[model samples]
Target: MRKMLQVVAISAALGLLHAGPASAQNRVTYKSAKTETSYYQMGVQIAEAMKAGTKGDIIVTLEESQGSTQNVMEVRARGGDYVFTAPPPLVESAQSGSGPFKDKVDPKFTEIRALFPIPSLTMHFVARGDKGINSMADLAGKTVLLGKGTFGATEGEKYLKLFGLEGKVKLADAELSNAVGALKNGQIDAFVTAGSWPAPNVIEAAASTGVTVISLTDAQVKETGREKLTIPAGTYAGQKAPIQTTSLPVVAYATTAMKDDVAYALTKTFWQQKAAMSSGAAWWNGVDQSLMPAITGKIHPGALRYYKEAGFKLNPSQM
Candidate 1:
């Protein structure tokens, strides 16, 4: 009896020694935009869908942050699994080492990997007619408000720099809601903001006072190397022509620490369920894989793997 018990104990010990490590659970925390905005809502919907679809292998949750710069900062500091951002801010941050990082390029800047891109928001630069702001050239020596956790501010600054208006203009920082009142009150000369067609604040300010939506000339667009968009006719109260300006792509990003399989599964799940996602938020519209990489910088190897396996052609830069 003692010999039999000893043999069974030894056998159990051997089995324990040979057993592979248990599958590590994947907990994905998505840092999204502010709570009241559509961006945040989209993140919530995606999180819920992924959580439901991933079964038990992955745990997904959503939280809100200030905007692009803050989201990027959080992703690095917290080691978050995913974050939502636009190409302009990311590009600007990497190039200037400004924005949230201010004076220094974040050490984790390279860890930012573009997963996929969604539809973009059009940037609108509105100036009170009395402010003497007429064209991009007129912005020199004026105060312009740019962005609110959005790319308009960062990209707008780039445009100013390109046009030789960097030191000439006062770049004021204010939220979109407050911008309308600020412009009406003459607190600032011009404001830069981005969003879908007919940004509500622009319309509201226009109704109360004469406001002009500054469009970027073609030459200016070419110099920035960013995507161009047109605010179509009848988009605003008095807009008569299609104003040409630049737009930024809203994209998903993952860190370098994320595994290829996890990024693959997450990317696959997003596309597979995007059809349903669009039904909830119109911003999810036009999430075509083909055009996403056009502006979004480098695609993560893990996400690139999924895109390639799914039969998508990626430009050399994205690869």
Candidate 2:
């Protein structure tokens, strides 16, 4: 009886040890910027899907980092297996390696991969119609609140520089909600945010207080190489006419260096179960097969494999 009991105990210990390594190999870590709502939510959906499809063999661990800059850095350092990032920043990082990560890393630190393009994030420079802040050019010498530590701040800075208004504008970073409140309370002259239509905070604030959405002129759009975007009439609670706007492209990526097979499996599962991703977040409502290419970057080998298998002809030049 004693010998039989020892054998059972030893077998159980070995099984537990083997399970640990197996679990570790299948697990992936993801880092995202807390300020990006859609990216954060997408991460949740992907993680859940991965867990479900892999029968828990694959586990996704997520942590909120500073922003795109930090997310890329963490991925490069192998601190995480995947990251969510915007296109401009991702391009800037991979091409120049000089902005947020200047002097600390090489340009090739990241292997750019395509995930999906988010709907364009329209730039809204909100101010009281009575404040006399009518256009981007008029932002000169004005106190402005740029959405705090978010992609909006990055876009605001980019546009300000393009229009030679950087030095003329006094910019401060404020959380989206706080910036809206400040604008409503007359504490700030204007608040700049870049987001898809009906950003809840902006809509709620605009509804509560009469706010003007500034439009970028054609000349401004051409000069900045920005896309001419519009917030359709009635997008906001009270706004009537379509709000003419302009925006730089905002794209997101599921960047990972995992084996192509692993990446392929995940991407395939994600596309097959797209509806599952939309269950909790409206943001995923826009993630259809048609919108995939707008995400600029090299598709992960795994994703590429799946795409090819699906009868999609991918041009090498496009990559």
Candidate 3:
């Protein structure tokens, strides 16, 4: 009986030791854009980086999102482990209870905090190369598709109105994911998509069927109050000249509900894997410490710790 009791005790101790680290693993939920979009692929890359960086100590899971607006709204029900992507302007709007979030105000919006800057959202107005749609005004009689409930959709509509082509252009009633297909099938003459450049769908459409990206005139771009961005020549198939467009900076965020230590790990891991990630995805190369000022809201305390340790400067607004 004594010998049996000793063996049982030893086995119990070994089991506890093996279970300790597994129990300590931190799980996080990441939400971004639609599955077919570049933003969604970004979420996947981040999740993979987190898993590899922490060696299974921290696990990040992705949740398919319709757009940035839905990502913000989910924060109300999501706990601390929830991480999401959105533009600084949207975060500000949520914080102030204005714009799309005006009527859906909740205290959870105040809990939101910044993590790090991701790639900027660059608008792409793609049309069939053979079509005569070379400029915004060319779309006067063409059918266009702008995915609903996304920054691209809203911005596309706003641009049409700003450029005086609102009612003149026929809007397609279809999802953004299907925009490329619709264009290829001649169901739509053009489509507007916004994501990090070299957007997956855009590349597919441009490669399989030549497409033309509209270059906004300087005056039209300025009227929208968005920063001008120029897509380099030859960025897409058959695209020979630089395309002038507008962009909105985007960022990752979390709420105070998350623990400080977990946030610290997430921030640290992201910077560490950034180089490796950029090697695989060109969009990641666009992100650097210089864009910190573009991040809205206060930085999460956990992330701030990593930034301080790394000696990265932060804007006053971030503090």
Using all chains and alpha carbons, the TM-scores for the candidates as numbered come to: 0.65, 0.72, 0.86
Model 3, 1-319: lDDT tens per residue? Answer: 9999999999999999989966689999999987877888999999999999989888999989888899999999999989999999999999999998978899999999999989999999999988988999899999999888777898999999999997999999999878878888999999999889878788999987789999999999899999787888887888889999999999999999999999999999999999989988988877889679888679999999999999999888887
- For model 3, the stretches where C-alpha displacement exceeds 4 angstroms are 1-23
How many clashing pairs does model 2 include? Answer: 0
Model 1: per-residue lDDT, tens digit, 1-319?
9999999999998877676334356888877677876666677787777766776566777877776666766655766466556554565576467655667576677777777775576678899977767688888877778755456666677777888987888877677567888888888888887765456578788888778888888998888886787667766777787899887676778777778888887888888778888776555654676556564467777788888888987878776
Error of 2 at 204 (Å): 2.4
Looking at model 3, report the run of 10 residues with the lowest lDDT sum.
288-297
Question: What are the Cα lDDT values of the candidates?
Answer: 0.73, 0.68, 0.91
lDDT of 2 by residue, 114-140 (tens): 654555566888876667777787788
Candidate 1 lDDT (Cα, whole model)? 0.73
Clashes of 1: 0
Error of 2 at 222 (Å): 2.0
Question: What is the C-alpha local distance difference test score of candidate 2?
Answer: 0.68
If ranked by lDDT, best first, what sequence of candidates would result?
Answer: 3, 1, 2
The window of 10 residues in a row where model 1 has the poorest summed lDDT is 16-25
